[model samples]
Target chain A: MSWLLDNFTLVTELALQHARLSAVPIVVGLLASISLGWLAHRVRAARLIVLTSFSLIFTVPSLALFVLLPLVLNTRVLDERNVIAAMSLYAIATMLRGAVDGFDHLSPGVTRSATALGYSPTGLFWKVQLPLAGPVLLANLRVVSASTVSLVSVGALIGKGGLGYLFTNGFQRNHPTEIVVGIVAVLLLALSFDVVLVLVGRAALPWIRNLGGTSPT
Target chain B: MIEFVGVTKTYDGGAPAVDNFSLRLAPRRITALVGSSGCGKTTLLRMINRMVDPTVGRVEIDGEDIAGRRPVGLRRGIGYVPQDSGLLPHRRVIDNISVVPLLNGATRAAARLRASELMAVVGLDPALAHRYPAQLSGGQRQRVAVARALAGNPNILLMDEPFGAVDPIVRADLQQETLRLQHELRKTIVLVTHDIDEAFLLGDEVVVLRPGAQVAQHGTPADILADPADSFVAAFIGSARGKRRLTISAQRSVDGADRVVVDAGGYPVGVIAAPEGRLPVADPTPRSRGAQVVG
Candidate 1:
């Protein structure tokens, strides 16, 4: 407890770094996944190829990925870019499948009617399909966010671990309290991301709330 | 007028869905296409809006080949009501109704204003405009679908089993409402239904279709009922079972004022005012005697 108080500023900076590492991959990966997923959905041939590539990418171990990214990206092993790049790849590998499932679950009637009612292809995607797929998309995003936050801790092995540095240093110094603080901080950060995502989903999709209840008429 | 000239639609080299079907839908009138499932009625309807392009031949609106027009632009100028109402569950009723107007570049306020007016025209309350489609009853949802179709005020309306999803009682009310709306709006409407009775009641001219969209019989309700083209048409209309053949049976009352129209099974169809003076008791063949009382 006294050690945590003494290192409060260092702890805060590490926590902030962890938050950024998690958030960047979550946002960037999801955006990239949405486009790839839509392309997979619209073109029959693209579905097989895109899904296969992502699945293969996901099977690659995270530690190996973090170590290997620096070489492929022409960056130093200790650079933050290697950690961020590795996490972003993992995010996309998971989220691309989620995005496809989100779009696939929409009712055929709604999409058919949209096309028949004069929606251009681009207009239908933005105005109808994507909005309807929000619940599932958000659910997948929550899972991805938590996983990304935890995965960033592995970057500590490469010297870029945000809060993960505590685990390595605490082990070397034989200090269990430092390790516990790091674990607690990561869990709290992941939880906060989950809560924020849920709130965002509810705000964006009002019709999902209070279903079957009638308004005054 | 919408015309299908030698139109034939085939899927993946299989049997033709609509095989060389040609029919002109008269403007400002309702034409009901009555057929069992797989008769290609839906395929034929979709071809008009270019939802499904034909494997052979052409469809034209006012003699202009629809193939020349972009499907999105063509569909905007024509109204389409699908079987499930197809209201966007995420959107409020006003938004669903105003979708097309907004797509066509109307200001949001103007589109919503048009939506509100259509709600009144289709017998929907303004209070219901803020609700989501899932919050409304099945009947109300269908009314919203009809209102949405009319929002653009297109000259043509294509309805594919628009009332088929509701209960029988609501179906009857919607059919009546549709007739009333048609009387006022006078748009060219092509309604697809498997129910022959619905076709007879709502269609100015009903086209009975066999499998593969063959025109089994096409005539006014009265003409088709009175003279079926063949045994298939007779069976399709249920005339072979004497279900559609009604006979007037006068029941005695203190005033002797009501005659019951009954089918062959002796079920009362409806009551009509009794004819003046004595008539043949429970006349069975009134139509040949030129004293028909029921249709």
Candidate 2:
């Protein structure tokens, strides 16, 4: 408690950085995944290849991939960009399959109706397909967000992971307080994001609020 | 004017679904294409908007070949109602009804206003417009589909068994609603159904198709009834099932009025009032909805 009080400014700074590190990757990764997922849905054989590639990337040891990305991108090992880019890649890997499933989750009957009613291809995607898939994607979003928050700590291994070096400092100094604080911070972040996601999802799909057998929850 | 000139559609070199079929759909009238399942009635209906293209024929609307037009543009001018209603589960009823108008550049407020009018035309309550499709009953959803189709104020409305999915009571209600709508809007309507009675009830002209889109006979309901083309036509219309043999011989109670027609065995087969030395003119007092009357 004394340590936190004494280092209040540092704690708040690190927490803010940690939140940014977690959130930016999620946003970037979701944008990338949405595009990639749509391509997978539109093109034959693209789904299998994209999903398989993302799965393979996910299987690679996080530290090894973290170490390897800097050399490939020609950036310094400890640069924040390295952590952000690597975390985004991880987020994309985790979310790509689920994103594709979100699109496939659209009802065939609805799609046929849209086409029959003179919805142009672009119009259908914007009005019907994307909004219809929003709820399912939101469920996947909460899961991916929690995972990203935890994974942001992995960047501390390379001296960039936010709130993660607290555990290291705890280990080195034989102090349990720092480790507990770190776990509490990450858990709090993840939980808050899950609630925000639910709220945003409800706003995005007002029709689903009263709909049953539609929401996964 | 919509004409199918020698239209033939085959699936991937397989046998023809609609083989060298041709017909003219009269303007602003209901023409029903009725047959059993797989008789290409649906395929023929879909060709109007180019949802299904005929392999070897030209479908023309107002002397313009439909194949030459952009499908989206072509379809926007034609209203379509499918068997299952196909209302988008995620959209509100008003949004579903306003889709066609929205696609055609109507402002949101304008589109919604038109949609409300269509809802009334289709016998749906304006209050239900804010509800999602899942919240409504099956019959209400079906009515919503009709409202949606009519929202564009389309010159032509194509219905592919629009009432097939609802209960018989709802089906009868929808049929009456359609009749009322036809009386007002008078749009060119092409209806597809397997139920012969439904075909005759609503169709100004009924084209009976056989397997492979063969036209067994095409005529008015009365023409088919008074003079069947063949045994196949007779069976298809259920004329051979003692339905045609029915004579206006007996009487039974109808709607608290003492005018109802009974069959040869004194059972109330229908209600018809034949004035002395005159043909039967069905007494046109609006009977209760869903009551079946035959002649």
Q: Who wins the lDDT comparison?
A: 1
Question: Which regions of candidate 1 are displaced past 4 Å?
Answer: A213-217, B277-295
Q: Clashing residue pairs, candidate 2?
A: A155-A161, A156-A161
lDDT tens readout by residue for model 1, A47-122:
9999999899899998888778878999988899988998898898888998998888889999988999999999
DockQ of every predicted complex: 0.63, 0.40
What are the fnat scores of the candidates, in the order listed? 0.67, 0.52
Worst 10 residues of 1 chain A by lDDT: A208-217
**In candidate 2, what are the lDDT values of residues A1-217, reduced to their tens digit?**
8877886786677788899998998898888888999999888799889988989989888899888988989999888888898888889998888889889878887888789899999998988898888887777777789999999898898888788878887889998988888888888888887888889888888887767533211
**Model 2 / residue A7 / CA error / Å:** 2.7
**How far does residue A142 in candidate 1 sit from its true spot (Å)?**
0.3
Residue B166 accuracy (lDDT) in model 2? 91
How well does model 1 score by local distance difference test? 0.89
lDDT of each: 0.89, 0.85
Tens-digit per-residue lDDT, B77-137, candidate 2: 8999998889887888999998999899999999989998888878787888788888888
| lDDT, model 2 | 0.85
Q: Give iRMSD, candidate 2.
A: 4.9
